[model samples]
Target: MPGYLEVLIILFVALLLFGNRLPNVARSLAQGIVEFRKGLKGEPENQEEKKALPPAGGQQAHGIPQGTQGGANAQGSQPPPPAQQQDPS
Candidate 1:
């Protein structure tokens, strides 16, 4: 972590460089980082992970494989449709 003095110096440089848009710039950078992390996890950018390990209602959610756990849509908020078999012809 950057120390207080280092942080203050960085802030001073930012104030000199960005004048007034520094906060907004920082906010956008943080949001971008969060989105990137979610992408890396194959998760939706802003959705919360379900507590599937606990099985919220003791029954499986619709469209999800029985006894399946982890990943999003675990709570059935946006369960994927059933898979269709492909033709071999």
Candidate 2:
């Protein structure tokens, strides 16, 4: 087992190496912990916010256009031809 002095030295070196990013690292770690706890309780992180927002009408959802939900290429456009490869002689 390492002594207290060895642990302190390791922590000091780590602080020096990550001094500038320590706060951001700590913040992200805290966020992860909160997310994990919410998951344990089966609670979504933004359920209330999602419910509060009004739905978007006549607009694309999940990148699919309003009338192109059931089929691909619903705009009557043809797919581009495959590129021709040249010989590397």
Candidate 3:
């Protein structure tokens, strides 16, 4: 635990360094963190999870519409079907 004097010192340093910009910087940092986490949450359905979806790009597979693998554009409503992607290895 930080001592009272240590806490005061930290606050004084923050006040000296940030002055009036601290709140704005904190808000921006929080928003950035939220966006970053949203990105990091990864593909919603994942490439491995199977779900019923409409035919993708007028193409059909096994009597069902073939769909784009995970990541954005997974939904049939998205613009032009995303190109098929494969692992580099």
Model 2 lDDT at residue 14: 95
Report per-prediction Cα RMSD to one decimal. 13.8, 8.0, 15.3
Rank by lDDT, highest first. Answer: 2, 1, 3
Best by lDDT: 2
Cα deviation at 67, candidate 2, in Å, is 19
TM-score of each: 0.36, 0.46, 0.36
For residues 1-89, what per-residue lDDT tens digits would candidate 3 score against the true structure?
99999999999998998889989999999999977886798645444443555546855556543454454656655678679999999
- Tens-digit lDDT track of model 1 for 1-89: 88999999998998898988878989999999988888898975433435334456677667878657666755765869989999999
Clash total of candidate 2: 0
How many clashing pairs does model 1 include? 0
lDDT of the candidates, in the order given: 0.78, 0.84, 0.74
Scored by lDDT, model 3 comes in at: 0.74
